[model samples]
Target chain A: MSTSITLLIPLLLGIGGFIVATSRARRFSDVGSGKMHSLPKYHGYLVALSIIVPAYLIIFLWLFFEQSVLRGVIVNALPDALTNGATPAQVSLLISQVQQAASGATFGNPDPAIVEVAGRLREAVVFSRWALPLVIVLVGLATAAVLVSRIAKRFRARNYSEAIMRGLLIFCATLSILATLGILLSLLFEGLQFFSRVSPIEFFFGTRWDPQIAIRPDQIGSSGAFGAIPVFMGTLTIAFTALFVAIPVGIFAAIYMAEFASPHVRGVVKPLIELLAGIPTIVYGFFAVLVISPFIREWLGSIGIAVSPTAAIVPGLVMGVMLIPFISSLSDDAITAVPQSLKDGSLGLGANRAETVTKVLLPAALPGIVGGVLLATTRAIGETMIVVMAAGLTANMTVNPLQGVTTVTVQIVALLTGDTEFDNPKTLAAFGLGLTLFLATLLLNLVAIQIVKRFREQYD
Target chain B: MMENVSFATAGAHARAPEMPVKMFGRKVEVFYGQKQALHGVDLEIPERQVTALIGPSGCGKSTFLRCLNRMNDTVAIARVVGDIRLDGEDIYDKSIDVVELRARVGMVFQKPNPFPKSIFENVAYGPRIHGLFKNKAHLQEIVETSLKRAGLFEEVKDRLDEPGTGLSGGQQQRLCIARAIAVSPEVILMDEPCSALDPIATATVEELIDELKQNYTIVIVTHSMQQAARVSQRTAMFHLGRIVEVGPTEKMFSNPDDKRTQDYITGRFG
Candidate 1:
């Protein structure tokens, strides 16, 4: 039978076991005190689950290992001259070539000894495809029959089912957490690999940031520099520009929504503000490139100053608008959470609305606002598309926002975007930059959490 | 001004005539949305004395107390249709700035609501915002005097810079009172300030309230009849959104003229 049809064998066995077990359970309860330990359906579920889980697990395992084991056996059976002292990469490539020849795909002229092995590989592949399903069907049916015999009135099917459910829930939760740690660890390892080739001090503190390396043995002017200071400083300058735009406008807009605007206005305006965030960063990058940069150039040119269309401030400014909703939404929640009684207390003391907001409300909500600001800062620093498209790729060290500059993320993209060797520092630098970005965001989140915790403790 | 329309129309026939009214409300009514919380009611608060509003839960006594300083203004839909005068000036008039009115008539909430700040900053907040003090030493003196009068200085004097939230429940309430007093208002409103405190703290705050009556006109709303009797010179009994009786504390406790007041005070039912 085909593999696709073979999947139905386990499912059919499970359904048959459930039917037989549930009938037996129902009869046992009806003939006795009518007090089965668990319900008849639970007994069915227990039998069904036992039949399905083990059967499917065996099928999956067989399918997973069948090809690798067959390939290894075929490789061993090949003539000594073909396999002797071969490196792993060479042997693996030969095995793939053999497999390709077996599949009737054109692989150039092969020796007669190799032709014999390719024929053997085809025979093995066909045999295993059939053997795997046959074994699976037999194992699935046998397991189902055994489980059917075990289902009884007193079986603790509910407990067993619940335990499995709990295990599954924990597995799913751990799966995501593990994925995050896995990403961070992979970044760290690759970054370490990059650092092995590049000296730490030169990479970190060196002023020059050229990342081009010589491709030919006699190529000149190919001494690559990997100093990250200029890139990081560019990131900081851009992030600060975004913050300078975001904090006041964001917080005041938040205050207006929380304290001043009518519910009707807030309901419409708040979502409209958040819509800025929902727009793709690529779109913001496009806007920065086409609209904002030209406006800045034209405006500055009129004033007898000049700037590249790809000035850092162009992306930085649009990024600030994108971050505004991010800050305002969180700040709104923080401000809204301050107790009304505190406001009353201040107002009752004859502090005007402005005085109450400035002295009492803001201070009480300060920690929360700081947390929001930190989160927004991290987001701005990690932002890629806008900087890549609008901010030039030159890792300039100048603090002047109008000059073209590149951020760490922008450089990381540039480094790894095209076909490149992983061993080269230029390409591996992408992973290093990724690790740094991850650590920066992780630290900001840690601080934000601590600030939020301190704020909660104050109220509690 | 409301003596004629009140349940105590016999003020002229009473033994202790009413002191010159410090603040009076005429035909006061409060509405939360469409529901009337306080029916048309008239009440007078005499100067330099503690007057307590005693009633069962949801009896409009607290509602009436909130109305005195227009504290209800904070509630968006809470409507007050009445004339409330503070020292003979209509406080509800559009010309009167609510901020200045609040500074002149400070309020203490039922729950202690001290700002999340140092104890010293908590007291100095009102003055700093209102420009109540001209210099640092002047501000310090005002804070110390307010704390002293609230009877909390000696315990917290050494730790004035500590967070106000760190104080115990009773101390926090006292700190709230000190914060209110720092504004140096002519009248102070207390809304069940001692309810959250223990018996000993309750006694301490009650004694302080009695001492404070010699300086400021105090209006307090209390659930405890004994608390009302112990701290107030005049007690007003409210029932079903109306004033059931108003008299001197001794008379209100001993020989209440209204049947509802007698029942409420005698613990027949609240």
Candidate 2:
């Protein structure tokens, strides 16, 4: 019933009802000796909203059930011999075939029982598809007429209109909250299944992280220890190294741009800095692997410092370059937002511009700058493409930036990229790693926000 | 304490007239980009006296104020051509160091702009940059004396380590004053320093400025005619980019030589 009219009839009727309601309200107000509460358009919108919302909801609800009811009738008609060997997925497929065949969609070989059931299912679906839309149209028109009829000289259409607007706004707001909850729930359930096979304690603290477990029970190479400590440490090392490279350079550049750079110099340099940010991270990763790594290795050899060809510094350096624009742009904005009077005060006191920046501008802009750096740090931590391509995928627990290392994100990708049975703990461990990565980034973000908030509170 | 105070007071007056003009500007004109902002203006700022420039909006009073120490040099498009002398030496001379000039001629702006730093650090910043003190104790003394002179020491003494931005608007302005004084500049340029302050804060700042003139040559630009009258010894009224009248504050406010100055003072035209 809901599907037959291609969903346009009810929509048009709803819009028409809205127009009539508003026009009628306007006419009533004109005849009476009173001020019209809301604009005619707003009143019309409110009537339209009422007509569309309920009928749309009813149509959605009917469509959601209509499939299940039709599928059930077809499923019941299938032979027991066919059903015994079939999985739930196959049964659904068979039901779909019956549905299509009934609709005259040239289905392949059908069972006699399916033929009978399919005929009945087709009649019910066709009838409902047509009848349901007509009913909704009638319901919408009747609801709109009723609402418009209530409009009179004293009607508070404006207040009702405002309420509807608020509800619409709230409906939009729920999307993000629901998406976050959905992700957390799916991860939690998957993690639970993985934990059932491998104890949570061993997964967290075991020293070995060899995850070559076979999908079949008889198969074996490495049973795989899923200790996450090394992966976590690697992420930290990369993030910290990247931040060390980025923060000082980014901050100084920001200060120079905001406080000291001449307009001519700023005009030339600011866009170049932003251009660095615009380059794709994947491209940066490619550069790290092909160009930066070899150059760093050469430099290290000259200095008599031996480093693996796949040095962590390779990816870290590229990540830092990627982050430079983020930090500089954000810090520049923060510094610029600091009142000019503060600079004047410092300069008036006979302080040099450098002193003024260090003492006044930097401190004033510290909270905002810190927020930017933290955001960049999180980006570096969860970064995958650069680390995967340049930083070796061997999980080596070392603090040296010159050493090759792999982060949790890379390990998770490696574990889950191949096809494997769901029961295998090796594959399941990827979910656990993902959860940890999510939590660490989330925690850092929460703490950063709190610090920024407290800093803002000081000035406010 | 009272005896010493009186003796200092008497000594201050005796030394006041003995000091010669520290800064002099002749036939000075300032241009921002292609637009001329300051017309030919001649003025002698005594070594230790409050000289105020007063005018309506866009009269170039602030531009004239910035010209004292070459603060206009910070703006790339701003051009100044003419002789500005510090102690009879032309400041516009090629050998001049702007950093040193700015150090000698500190400025306070209309709004309080305390750095987002500890109150102690804010005051120490100027001195530290100039290498004014030998050690921490000497630095502390400079901070204390500067704050005391700005009339902020007593209120902020216990909370010296707190962020200067945490202070009230009045205290922050005074803190800025203290920060400026910490560098021990010969002259102070204030551009409408009290415009952002409430009446009480304005009064406090005005009192501080009055006391400060004994040690520092002061040039203040103000839009408020009443503020110029209260704080200045010599008043210069500017119209457009030109100086309309220059004389003792008393004569300028009571009986101006220029009709425009007179009209501006009477609130007839701005």
Candidate 3:
């Protein structure tokens, strides 16, 4: 059987189960429609779930255990001399290569004995793939047919169907929550491993961050320190600069759109600002590196102020421009949500448009506007591509925007991108930086939500 | 009662009617887009008297009230055609200042819309803008007197620094009234001032309105006939953008001259 045909086994079983259950449900209901409690589709779904859910569970179990069992047998059959002194990761890599060689694909370090064992494993896998899916399909369809044949005029198919549906929805909800918990647990385990190697204090507080590990034990002057302060400081400086640029422009644009501009002008300007947001950050990064930075460098040269070619200011400026649409769109919605009667009250008091906007409208929209700025702050902090391309990877601890800096995310990306050993502190330090970045953004988002909630209460 | 109208007529007969009119509107017509909303409205609003305009929905009663203070100019598509005179000077004249005109003639809306500010600031906004107060104490006095006149002083006296939006709907409406009165305008226009308020609050505002007419010319647009009859000496009924009947409140309700006005007041047709 083809690979796709094998995968189609569960799909066909599910469809057959649905068809049989629905037809039986209809026949049962015909005896007395009032007696049946739930819909026909519910019965179909119940039978389908019973057929596929358990069958897939068994299939997954079998696939997992069978692969391990077969791999163990092949490992045992390997020559005693070859298996000695190999780590678990290296052994797994060797097994993968052998399996590839047996399947008529090129693999590293070809060995005749391993090649022979790989051929046997390949043949077994091909046979199992052909026979296993056929057995599953036949079992699924037969079970569904037998269940449908047992349904009688007195059978509570509808109730049974509803119970199945409720279970299925609950199962889906639980599955998502469990998946989230599983991810968090995996991150925790990795972070714990990172913490064991580098103390949490050194990771968080010690200023000089240098993540370079020696591959060989004989190498001299090897040092791998993961102090995250410089990275965090760089992130804060860039993010603050971006906010300084984005908040005023975005808020003023939003106020002009909401209060001052004519509908015609607003209609034209709103989409253009949104278009600025739609342009990808990578494009902005490109503009920052090739055009903006060069121009800024030349301008600084003319003014007699020395600036690095890849200064943080160019990246901050480009990121701020990228964030303008995000802030403006949110602020516009918040300003527009302010009640019209408030504006009228201020105007009725003989206050001009400017005074009414400043004293009444802006104050009412303050929380929402601040929420938008906070959201933009998080976005700027978590941004990777702009800082990676525009801001140079030298971690400089200075407030000057005209200096090279490296953010945590950019460091994390650089650490893991090249040929990295899994056990080395150099590569594992990325996970530590990632955790800190995640926590910082998470805190920022919570603050944004709180501000939005306070804004809502003021109006509602 | 109808006897009150005759009593005023008798008083006018004895006094030689020597006092000149404070404001006059001539042939006022308002159009929203292509639709004419107010058709040839002409009236003389006497100073320090409450005039109530009563009509069903879409009768241009609110439109006429907005036109008195040139609030209609804010709407991009709305056009006002007529002459409005304040103290014998045409308000729509080329040289006339709209800001001064609006300061002289303050307004109140149907919904109580307090600024997102302290209670004191809400009342102080108008006075501060018009330069009606010279110092802090004078401003405080104006705020206190306006709040007292609006009957909101006792309720909000302790928490003047609290946001005005924290007040109840009725209290907020009175706060808006105090805000209007703080500027010391000669005229105060209200558009359906009690529509969103409860009965008790409506009664309170009605009492306040009766008292306010002693000092300021009050023009109010309302849908409630009883409210108009209770607080207004003169009532104007509008039908389909036209003033169907306008006369003394007692006469207009008890014996309406126009058929449309009679039908409207009798609850037969709107």
Candidate No. with top lDDT: 1
Candidates arranged by DockQ, highest first: 1, 3, 2
Model 3 clashing residue pairs (backbone): none
Docking class of 1: medium
Candidate 2 regions with alpha-carbon error over 4 angstroms: A1-7, A29-34, A76-90, A96-132, A214-217, A264-268, A293-310, A454-460, B1-19
Candidate 1 per-residue C-alpha lDDT over A1-460 given as tens digits, one digit per residue, 9 for 90 to 100: 5788778877887788789878877777343565667787777877777777777777788889987897787788789898899998988888887877787885578777777888998788778878867776677667667766776666787788677668778988999999999999999999999999988788889788999998876899767999998999899889999999999999999999988898889999999999998999999989988999989999999999988766778988999999999889988988888998899889888888788888988899999899999999999999999998888888888888888888999999999888989988989988878888999999999999899788877666
Candidate 1 clashing pairs, residues 3+ apart or interchain: none
lDDT of 1 at A375: 92
The estimated TM-scores of all candidates read 0.89, 0.89, 0.89
Q: What digit string (tens of lDDT, one per residue) describes model 3 on residues B1-270? A: 233322222321232222346787889999999999989998877787778898899998999999888888788899999988999889888898777888889999999988888999999999887788889999999999999999999999999999998998889999999999999899999999999999989988888888897789999999887788778777889888888788877678778888888777777776
Q: Residue A118: error of model 1 in Å? A: 8.2
- Model 2, span A228-325: residue lDDT tens: 77777778888888888899889988988997888889988999998988898789988988899888888888999998977778888889988998
Give the range of the ten consecutive residues with the poorest summed lDDT in model 1 chain B. B1-10
Model 1 regions lying over 4 Å from their true place: A1-159, B1-17
Interface RMSD of each: 0.8, 1.9, 1.0
Tens-place lDDT per residue, model 3, A150-254, is: 666556666776677788799899999999688767767777788889999998998888887767788876487688888888888888888889999999999
TM-score of chain B of 3: 0.92
Candidate 3 chain A lDDT trough over 10 residues, lowest sum: A29-38
Better of 1 and 2 by TM-score: 2
